[model samples]
Target: MTGERGSEQGSPVRNGAGPGQEGRQPPVIAIVGPTGSGKSDLAVRMALELDGEIINADSMQFYRGMDIGTAKITAEERKGVPHHLLDTLDVTDEASVSDFQRESRAAIADIHRRGRRAILAGGSGLYIRAALDVLEFPGTEPAIRQRLEHDLEVSGLAPLRTRLELVDPVSAARLGDARRVVRALEVHELTGRPFSSFMPVREYFQPAVQIGLEVDRELLRERLAARVHRMVSSGLLDEVRRLDSLGLRRGRTASRALGYAQFLRVLDGEADEEQAAEETIVATRQFARRQLTWFRADPRIHWLDWQDPDLVAKALTLCG
Candidate 1:
């Protein structure tokens, strides 16, 4: 399912290595952490050292023109390593984890075909799992989905969340968005099964390694707060102004992105820029906490201190 390899440098993993190339090692690396934990930086370092490529698992990085807020690494930062799946979607379009699973698998396979290491990096938990694990997506009935959407629009998320709470408290508690709430209801209505039943067990679809960056909670909070300030100084407001012209508010997913959602208020004159920036920081810190909680539950992840000078070497050791 891998897409075309963007470079011709290294040998892919062993399974797909050609004749006389049985000795070549295929790398499947996942770098996961909180939002401001320097995951993209470490991923780039690993790619350069291992002759690998990066596949983005962060849902926000998928949107074009969302660079500054998502903290997307620049082209120069990639340092000639071929990065996959960034800036692939319109800001107005919603990204589906299942679609990401299909595309990222293809990209990783293609990276393997080229005999290069495949590094998956991002803070998005489910998207990362959907790509690297044996996750199955439930089928959606268009009519059922339409009805749910209708109900959400008419009655708001309360009724739908109540329904989901009755059928599946776990999913109801886990999900925060109206869209996802409606989806859980749809799944139950369609299959007579709780939405949680579709969740994949903790198992990889292929041989893989996960490197998690661990941060001190207070330090991470300060870092996240500082990062939000930098984004504002670096023109997050202007970026939102640009995307707003492209129907960002109408977008079901992109509209809800931490910084984007808050700044949209600024544009509408609902709040001042400083207020928007403060909200973004608060929201980002909460997001980072949730991210840490999610990754901590996975037993397979190898945790590394975020500030360790030899973090890359430590992560490499785990790959073997």
Candidate 2:
């Protein structure tokens, strides 16, 4: 999200979409939005209508056995439309946007090869960009990475975070996780440039169409709270408990997930489940805000009202 770039002049799609446009130069359709904004449902509808297969851009949904917490779409919910990149990683595996870019593009290529429209869907802005934009990841040096990792362990993130703020404040603000923070710091150390400076200039690596979903902020907050409550009632705690035995706590990214992290405190006797659920709701809401902020910066995305009655029909028209 931090490194992603786009125009600020993005306007909503009108009835003047390419209705007769098909197969001339096939476009990769990207569905993006804030969490709990129904991006997945909309994507499924689009995929169904367009004879498309989906390539996931949601980073959390990549992990296996992370269904409930991440709100991963169930197989039945997939409606027999083929989906790529879900449950492809173990909870213990670390995921980088670079790796995601590589894998997702491959999936997209395969979907195209099969003569199906490739629908990219998720709220992870950078992952989506990595898959579709001309973004380049900074090369890594093992020794530098090792040193940063050592520093992180010995002194904790505060000092390293301070350094990142001084050297690459943009990356520093966008990255809350220690792993990403350390990587950003390493990039600065290795390249003598701010991590953000390597961001993609507003250009796509592949021709693509981006559709954005926007929700009223107040309504979204209420919806997010209710969704988190539903997650708890639907066995998010039990899911975490099962994952913890599989070394989920050791998983850098998985351990830091909104619900999983808060519930970890509950499991440790530091909080109650209700309190944990409340914390999860608050954290998820904050995450949704960040997501909105990230997508809002990109003006190329055709914005659509999330609750529009003709949302699917309008989206298909845009694709057409």
Candidate 3:
């Protein structure tokens, strides 16, 4: 498809076969990459140039008051571009992929209503995949959820993992970790079907284009280190302390976030500032590596080198 170059405020001009000939819908663009890879900045630029609104796909950025640690874009950074799904919930609230999918769909629909493109942007592969694929999980029974919570509190995750392995070995095999195992077992007990059975392989959206940012490993590592240091300098410890006061204790999902976890260790007197920052950097690097692994496995994404000066043009071409 080819189109006229339009201004940022106007709709993109289209010059190709219209939607529906091949069961395709209007194209939506997504910018995905490892954390600290400038995905948001690129998304903002694309939005300004392509008449798009950014829908955040990052999991952590959903929580309110998690700006510094999450590397959340500030108002000034957005440059008047409208962004959706960031800082929309309290840290105490549990936001899941289902919630993200629902909210993102609404945001995309709104963008389409405005005659603009929707730009999905973040490092969270699971959230992006959940939004793009028609993957649904079985409903959970309240009573079963309560029971599972009680069991988890009483016996911890090992028994839950064992139970899940017995009920749904496929899901259990895929979710052998303590956190995932508990969730899988909870879903199994709540709904009749295995968790794995709910995973749909069909496309959820139509005519979507995925663009991944690529950076040199050494440069990424250096940038991550600097980012962690900046977070430390920018009151990340204070932020963790506030969240801790909200009853988000250590080792829970919220507390285990990269910067927050390190600060929690420092709060427990387990580490010094230097040690905490170093450990946070290391953990973030490891997390980025995992993101790369996940993104690499997805064949649909087109990778663009972040170092390229004309990345926006390359991304726009890819979107076309």
Candidate 4:
């Protein structure tokens, strides 16, 4: 699924090409790839090499007590580079893409004002787009949203899903959860347009370069499995247990995280640790595949070998 890069080596990577961005700034560098593909490590290395700070694009890392399961970078790993938007939410708070876009743009502006380059890093594809792309979120109407949510509560997702399929089949095919389904219907009700019509075009809101780490599918599968096993070995259950006590199960988003969900079942006696580990490994691999599919569709990202010894240097060249 690999695609050709839009810019070549040493070519000036275009920034702020979207409409109304006349005073184009230096590109905000973003590192993107599937999970367990060493994105965090590479991001830190690039930040140090370029004298930049990091803005997290991973939604799962937003929760305060979700470190181990999300594989969040430690303080030492940051090596003094200020990372924004990590651990900014309680487990009970739902993550919002619109909120993330506002916060990330603010952070990017702050970093640039301080004369430091802004580096955005994470495997969350949509969050990455929200930060760097010229994307618009549909406004929500309180009455419409409340009504759809009430419908979802009373009749279940089937009715809402059917309504979405009739009004906005593209989103219906794409969105599977109750929350997103209700959101799609709400967007349609509010704007009288298909939810998919608002998908971001290939235009940057600011000067930006995306560097994607390419991995062999089989090798990535192995790495993800190994990583899940390591998380289990390194007190992931204890971390999940603690978060669960702090209202993890009450969280609409955090409770459904890949590793955390599987282990929460283990905590409830529905599964054992071994069963949870295997389930998490399988789910993580599937998630990686979905991430690859989303990223590969974008032709602007410069792809690099994850194992390349000079990965940072290559990425820097792309950033120019």
Candidate 5:
């Protein structure tokens, strides 16, 4: 599963204040919010205050050369604090939640080893949940995935959905969509277990704090629109063009990023700048809505109005 920490194979547990010492470890502070909600700013400030290092949880920000559209924090914006997992992968590479979890755990452990706090920040709820809850997924077979891919190409997702519904009704109910059903079925065919059954039970790092940023919907919409305009002005189209030249046009997960997908359409002559920007804003707004839904369902999050005067103080109190 993406973001779940498991026991290290062949590694011995240390006594007292050492690695894997959950009982004696310092808590990780996770700052999460929707895209365009200033989570990077908040995380940087929190890191400065708490002597923390940041581990990125956003899925899209990991790719190289995606700076403007993903709104990756500049080195100056990082304010001399160490940030991990940004711009670490090429666009041709595939990144997954499991990859994030493994890397993030190592980074967090290193931060703790250096006697600094670990700050997890970004807008990807799945990545954040994987880190916090330590959920794990079952392994899949390549042949099963290949067969499912063929089915998707020939009969579409209906056959896959029916197969998954028979094998993993709980996962089928939870997924409820064609693409997800196909994926679940692929995993079931590979592992012989319900996809959802592989999920780890909820777990938490004690003494940790979670801060969520919220804004008025209209305000967020305006911000998203303005951000899209700025990105276009900043050569986002050129960036997409370069990525497309690398044979990452569509269907790939990296190509599906809000700005990249819209601009790819522009390059295909299917849309103009204005249309691309409009579509990007609409997609981004929907993504933000989904993020809010995911975070709001978690009872542990300490909600903060984006304009709160004493937000940092409140977060520090929770961390203590």
Candidate 6:
């Protein structure tokens, strides 16, 4: 139980505010949405209005040199609000959900201690859940993990996927990557339980409100495509090159990021910038669709139209 914020560890409010002050504490506010859906801007606006700080839940934004492709908020865009957890990891480091859970919970507790709202913002579904939900992470056994990874490298994903399907059909249906397939098999072998058994239920770890940004599917596709093009025009390739030189390619998670992955091909002379941009656009749109599906499944989220003129006010109402 690596990600478990156990009862013995105490609640976020317990360390920050006493029982008498609990009634006065503001609920943790989370702004969640797909890429290019204005989550960061809305988070900033809400922070300004609510006297709050932002804790980034975007896994990509954790990397120090991954700004352009991840659309990390500019210093000016943060508007002097103290943002937590951005640029905390090197591009060569793999982002871990359990580690994020511990760090983000600590940040949230600190924000509450200062009596300011903690606004969790980003599009990463699992990272967001790890921050706000009663989630538990299974401990990793390196030997088993390495063996499964070696199997994946030698036998490929199909054989491993089939093995997972036999033991855990739910996770087999849900997971779509070789890395995750390996992780699922590793978990099962270590614990003798299906990996899906560890999935977080829709239970909040603390008083929290989730505001989801809803956008028209076609409009979001157009926005994502245009955003990728803008990233290209705004030196995304140069940023990728800089990070690549810093061993970005060696990082398991950072190297596979949307624009970074496609752009790496361009650097290798396999594809030109235009082809990379188009491919990135396609991949980004597909990612957005998956994000929408994940966020939509949570009944607790209050959905707001991304273009609503009174969006901030509506979100504030939900927070209250």
Per-residue alpha-carbon lDDT of candidate 2 for residues 1-320, written as tens digits (9 for 90 to 100): 11111111111111111443333447899999999999999999889988999998898898899999999999989999899888887778776676677678778777877889999999988888877777676777779889999999999999999999999989888879887788788778887988777776667766789999989999999998998899999999899999999989988778898899999998899999999989998999999999989988988899999999999998888887
The runs of at least 3 residues in candidate 1 whose Cα sits more than 4 Å from the true structure, single-residue gaps closed, are 1-27, 151-178
Angstrom error at residue 269, model 6: 0.7
Model 3 gets an lDDT of: 0.77
Q: Which stretches of candidate 3 lie over 4 Å from their true place?
A: 1-25, 149-162, 200-202, 250-252
Q: What do the candidate models score in CA lDDT, each in turn? A: 0.84, 0.83, 0.77, 0.84, 0.78, 0.86
List of clashing residue pairs for candidate 5:
1-137, 2-97, 2-98
lDDT tens digits, residues 143-253, model 3? Answer: 666677788889988788778888998987787556556557666666666778766464645568899998899999999999999988989889888888876563234
The true-versus-predicted C-alpha distance at residue 35 of model 6, in Å, is 0.6
> Which 10 successive residues of model 5 have the least lDDT summed?
6-15
Provide the lDDT at 285 for model 3: 98
In TM-score terms, candidate 1 sits at 0.87
Alpha-carbon TM-score of each model against the true structure: 0.87, 0.85, 0.86, 0.89, 0.90, 0.89
Clash count of each predicted structure:
9, 2, 0, 0, 3, 0
- Against the true structure, candidate 3 reaches a TM-score of 0.86
Which stretches of candidate 5 lie above 4 Å from their native place? 1-20, 205-207
Model 3 lDDT, residue 17, Cα: 29
Can you tell me which runs of candidate 2 are displaced by over 4 Å? 1-25, 149-181, 188-194
Error of 4 at 193 (Å): 3.0
* Candidate number of the best TM-score: 5
Task: Looking at model 3, report the run of 10 residues with the lowest lDDT sum.
Answer: 1-10
Better of 1 and 6 by lDDT: 6
Candidate 4: regions farther than 4 A off: 1-24, 152-162, 172-178
Give the candidate number with the greatest lDDT: 6
